[model samples]
Target chain A: MAERTPTQTPATVASPDPAAPPPRRRRRMKDLRKQPGFDTMAWFCLFCLYAPIAVLVVFSFNDNRSVVRWTEFSLRWYRAAFENDGIRHATWISLQVAFVAMVFATTFATMAALATTRVRAFKGQTLTYAVINQPLMVPEIVTAVSTLAFFVLIKQVTGLNGIGFLMLAHTVFCIPFAYMPIRARLEDMNLTLEQAAADLYGTPFQVFRTVTLPLMAPGIVAGAMLAFVVSLDDVIITLLVGGPGETTLPVYIFGQIRRGITPEINAVSTVLLGLSALLVSIFFLIGNKRK
Target chain B: MATQTEIRDPGTPQAAAAQDVMIHAEGVIKTFGEGAGKITALDNVTVDIRKNEFFTLLGPSGCGKTTLLRLIAGFELPDRGQILLDGQEIGHLPPYKRPVNTVFQSYALFPHMSVARNIGFGLEMQGRPKAEIKTATEEMLALVQMEHLANRQTDQLSGGQQQRVALARALAPRPKVLLLDEPLSALDLKLRKEMQIELKRLQGETGITFVFVTHDQEEALTMSDRIAVMQAGCILQVGTPKEIYNNPARRFVADFIGDINILEGELQQDGGAVLLPGGASIGALLPEGAARSGKVSIAIRPENMGLTAPDAADASLTGEVTNIVYFGAGHNVHVALDGGGEVLVRRAQTDAQVGAKVGLAVPDAVQVLVD
Candidate 1:
């Protein structure tokens, strides 16, 4: 109990000068940030990821016909993409699918998220969560193949071969993308706010309309945007499920690639990339603003 | 000076009237989880809160004060028994169907709504006319003195401002009863003191039965008309501040509310005088129907006893001053008695020296505690 530590040593304390300036210490935080090779490794990884996309974007504006070798900047490929009947028709189809799928997916995701989060623990809750997020975990190729087989059987039974099958496939796959942000938002939401609303004489439906919906608007918008981008950029599922002449932009671009590599393909891909980037940026903005 | 504030027998003609009882909870029990993980939050609690009274539930954490408040608010339903509001059983009603509102401990204001809109929410939900809702909302804003911040979003306000908004919002609908779950706990000391007075005034002005819950004994004493002291999911005692402080029904209430010294004692064969551990005797102030001849525990408030000379004839116990702790107003003298126990004595000024022998002169206010 009487043991003395170094700080309690009388000799060291007595030896210190009263008026001397203290020694300058190196900051540990700045030193940690400047760890050797870290900056280089980070930049190299970013470059590896984005360098090919950057090349594709630049080549999309090439004046020459060669896809990889850019000679001079021109809007010729963009103009060609705009004027091409097949590309125009496929893009319109893609937009319609994305819009319709986004609406349905966001609705289902919101309901599913609320069901899983805003209630007491019940049987099959874990399994319900798993099923909601199943599409996100499963491989895209497997989903595409299964949907293709399912739609083929449906066509034979119903004697229908409309674009409904492709729309259904996109909507199904986009659910988990939409569900992720919505469920996260619902989880982060304060439970007491809803309780307070109920305490204020708002019925269950009224509380949902007045309090829960308004607070959840940002998450719903973000989820919808993410779902739109995901559906718009989908290639495998669209290709597998689309009927003749019901090709989407990504599938149409795939068919063009098989025929021959053209600067027009780069142009179309760049447009798709830009659209996805714009929507994803909007999604991020809405998501981050909630905090 | 308030005494005999216990729950009267319901079979009495006066007790059955029910007009003054704003909220009555009978044999209420609430438990969380199921099977082995179950924890009973409230155990057979039954109490009556009078109309227009600032009633408070005071206890330490997990003592079921907030749980009881929530039960009255209709946020949590009792697994057994019934809660009555003005003689009507409301235990089965949902929160929205019940005519009560809560100022949550966290002050759960809607972040998206402006101050005025938030206050108007309950009115709007009731489908009141636009003009009436606006008038009531404006009146509530003026009541809480937040009229200038009417259009400001809730997230823009400070802690105290948000607390006022929450109070205003809950009060807008003018419910018959208001449940405040430690609303002032989030405030700093000076602000909390201010809000305590403000809440008491609001309760008076609105004539709403306020069931406040807090762990702070000072807050309960300052604001409540009557306080219910709880421990381990049961109400230990129910009385006004004076009664609770002076005549604690349980040792837990005595030790919890203020500085109290409990000593082991025994009642004499004739039940006239109680024998202290240090061979001193004092007249027994036993409650009716209590044990007449047995070992018992006794509680005395620190300030109620005085320090005297070691050989004083009227001394109830003798001890040595072990420690002296100073506060701005007074000091507490910790004493180690010769009978192998410790007691704390509060003194405005003490002449006794540390480690010196002293005598404690017990007053007639010594409370005999039941187990």
Candidate 2:
């Protein structure tokens, strides 16, 4: 029919091939070979992103104290950072905080995403979403100050003191980060699958469990990673709200930086940077797999 | 010319109630927007969909055809009517609670799930035993001939392949009714034609009531056991494909269904002959007790417009062949009438040419659209 129609019909040629794979491959090949100004601009943008990470990797192996200057290569800081008890304890605290915060963040983000996208009408939806995103919108200092004030007020009423409040505060900040990714994932998801599931004898709740939740996993995983990063790196919120013996890694690193220049601090920073890099690499490896 | 009209549904009112009517919708009304200015999507539409039948809601895009499909699927709530599934009022029930499924136009297979998982999802939700889900999923996958790709992710499959997976997924549970909303509309023309046959085959194999919604005339005609042609928000007519195409009850139905050569004529000769608007006389074998008088229209299929060179006086509107299009299957010739209006003649491409002056016989091509 195509052979016949192409000979006779004057309609525009939109080949019925839905597999656009070959064209995409050919386009990439053509662009690489041509190397236009647009290619230079794109490469320059990539260099802008990658150069700092390169510098950070180089500095991790440097013997010098400064971030830029390099001396003889050494693994001394990495070894020392691994050995320091304060750094180890702080790392453990950050891990605990991130782990706990992830649980809260994933749950809240999922519920919030569902409520935002599903259900016909809900009272104060925009307000609820804005409140969920408060940690991201308001200044970190403001959040810290508010967390302190809220904790003090709680203590004044009925004392519930500990870094537990600090964890909760960090969870609040991680929500928007988590919610951002989950919501974006939800936006990409097609609603027809849920409808199809329902039509195929699944109850609304069953459809969510079998269809919607499974489809949203990738997004939930992304949100969890973002939440973990936020929780681990949080300084202002933990600094103001964390109680005794609950100093987070960033707080510990802050104190060290203020004190004096030392290989121990560099060692600790290197370890922290390594963990983040590991997490980021895993995130991309899992998340960026194409169909 | 008082010939009898042998309608399948006898004119007696009792015939409407006595049948194996699987679905009964009573006076369904749906209105969008609110208050006095509300737009009526379905205006008191009442239809009975029979069991194991291929039924189509055929109409233009916004003619409440999809709204009716949704109403049947429990996705939509009619404003002031109840629908009964197996004689139980289930219109108010949500889509999940209803014993029906839909094959969406988008073929919405879960992108994250493997084809087997996608098809087995409904069984999993019902807490079916693992072995049962596994066996049933395999059978369904085999039914759609997608068993080979069971472990493959849905997003990786082609559009037609994904559509088959969606079909397997929907048909896995074996619902009482299968509502398809323009299911083949998203596919390429060749694939759409292929899926049409596959859908029909599957419908026969499963023996479930299929409520298909489509704006394509040929798709509706080729697939449905009965088609309900709708306009605006009202059903213009409902009949078998042959009935709708061969004997259209309205002018719009004639125009919408397929290529029809329409000739405007004044009702004359006490309903014997029609004096065409272009002053050409033509004869019609009118249906008994049909149109009355004055202004009327005559419609005939393009193939029914026969050519007799240019030597006739009392024939279908005599026209000169302006252009001929070779559509592979047949030659569609465009003809300009000597009076005013034009005529389209479709003939076998075996022996036809362009710019050939021809006289069309109007004896069979004339029908009293209005009288």
Candidate 3:
């Protein structure tokens, strides 16, 4: 088997030489062309996915109020978005909620992921895994409505309603999103290192702090970024559960859309899109570093 | 060979007192899973490892050797007994509290740390001074001859190199005992052989009780001062390598340790002799209280049987050579006996071709086993 590998390369390289007969060359070209439409469909899907976002980004610089028409290129809406007081307040609220939610979600999700992946097999392991992932399996609108009802019930019983409620709702919704990467990282880890650490006089907590946690950093960072993005972009749940003075950026943008289609909305959406792209790029950077 | 005779009688008071026992496991039982799915990993396993001796748990995979090692290391808790280290009961202590370290089968080096850091990690966990850790880490690196690769990440090292680093790391803290779980199983045959010698040298120099676990019988024989052969969660026998190889206590032990030919026969009226069904009589050791009429099994090592010309005067049995397997060091001649049995004779070199008739001679000390 080892000897055959070196011989195989020269045969493949020599077959593609121009010195080869034209008939065989034509047959090889035909074979290459005979591939199925998977590549074409992939290209089509990519264009479909990115074209809308590209258009929205381009129109964010439009001078005119209309978003559909291509007018003179300007930063008019960007300046308008920056100047708007309501947008600014809503952006602040969204940042606060996303930051807090990211922290709590990442912490709880990391713990949940470790418990589900690292713990030995138990009777309720499968059930616990399913329950942790329930938020991702349920529809977004259902989560929003159910959370709203739950909050209403809590308010009826204890009368607690504020930005705290919105933050809590977002944290719950973002848990599965954060959990996925952390769990994947935990599962990918070589468990023997932890065992070796324990054998080398490291206590359980010491092993976790010295070996498991450092190895899990990439996944935790990625999960935190994902949770942040999800919390930042959430609109339905915020609209349903948020009280006055608790409007997030997405909720504010939805209100602006209902009032009218403005380039300012496109400008804000472009900024949000850029932020998410930056977060995603950071996630990939950490992932690549781990590799 | 001299050491083998010295430790031959493990029950002797002088031997037991001279070599202080390091680890003692008493009626240890461990089971995995619950109810119907439960699998008994170790069943009432009791063994004493002498201080500073190179002890081995030798068996095939799933024979509970690794479970026994883990039990002593405190990675596992026994359902029904105690494990003692230097006369201290350590069964209730977690792995970290136990004064033992394991070189994992996978090497399990911390991929993110440098070789030096990996070797120093245990010391750091002990809260050793930085200067002391540095000096000790360099000493360990020197011991393993990995000083040139001290700064290299563990992932950058080869399998053999990583194994050394793991050993260095486990040894840095200078534990009273070290456990190695098939540490050389990942290396190629040549490197595995080299590491085997190196491991023995290290164990001798450090004078730490080394409990090595492996399924490779040759490796166990080459490295262990004393070996405990395990099967089906029970210890079949414990003896020196020479003792285990020459005088196996069970059929499984005989078959597992090395090449052997087993012949079924009945004990003759004259003791110390077995009569085959084909009317061939072979010398053997008769067990005490043996039934004078029932069948018995005799086992002989392939190397012990000699091959002679068919017309030789003292030939006990005649057979036709069926096959010859050449193993560079020696060759095995497979013979089909005329009496409806087959045996293999190990020879240095043989001009005997296939289909040549050969005479076989069985030694006097054939192992007799009664079922």
What is candidate 2's DockQ?
0.34
Give the CAPRI class of candidate 2.
acceptable
Question: How does model 3 score on DockQ?
Answer: 0.34
Q: What are the candidates' individual DockQ scores?
A: 0.33, 0.34, 0.34
Provide the lDDT at B74 for model 2. 79
lDDT against the true structure, per candidate, is: 0.87, 0.79, 0.86
| Greater-lDDT candidate between 1 and 2 | 1
- Model 3, A1-291: lDDT tens digits are 112334224223322344668889899888876789857987899999999999999999999988999969999899999999999999999999999999999999999999898877778988998999998889989999998998899999997667899999999989999999999898999988898898888988899999999999999999999999999999988999999889999999999888998999999999999999999999888877856
- Between candidates 1 and 2, name the one with more favorable TM-score: 1
lDDT of 1 by residue, B250-353 (tens): 76887888788888899985667788998878877665346788998888888988999989987778999999999989999999998898998999999888
Ranking by DockQ: 3, 2, 1
lDDT of 2 at B17: 58
Q: Which candidate ranks first by lDDT, i.e. highest? A: 1
Better of 1 and 3 by lDDT: 1
Candidate 2 — which pairs collide?
Answer: B292-B371, B293-B371, B309-B359, B316-B362
Query: Candidate 3, which segments miss by more than 4 Å at Cα?
Result: A1-34, A156-159, B1-15, B268-294, B309-313, B323-327, B349-358
Taking all chains together, the TM-score of candidate 3 against the true structure is 0.89
RMSDs, each prediction?
8.6, 6.0, 6.6
What is candidate 1's lDDT per residue for A54-118, written digit by digit as tens?
A: 99999999999998776999999999999999999999999999999999999999999999999
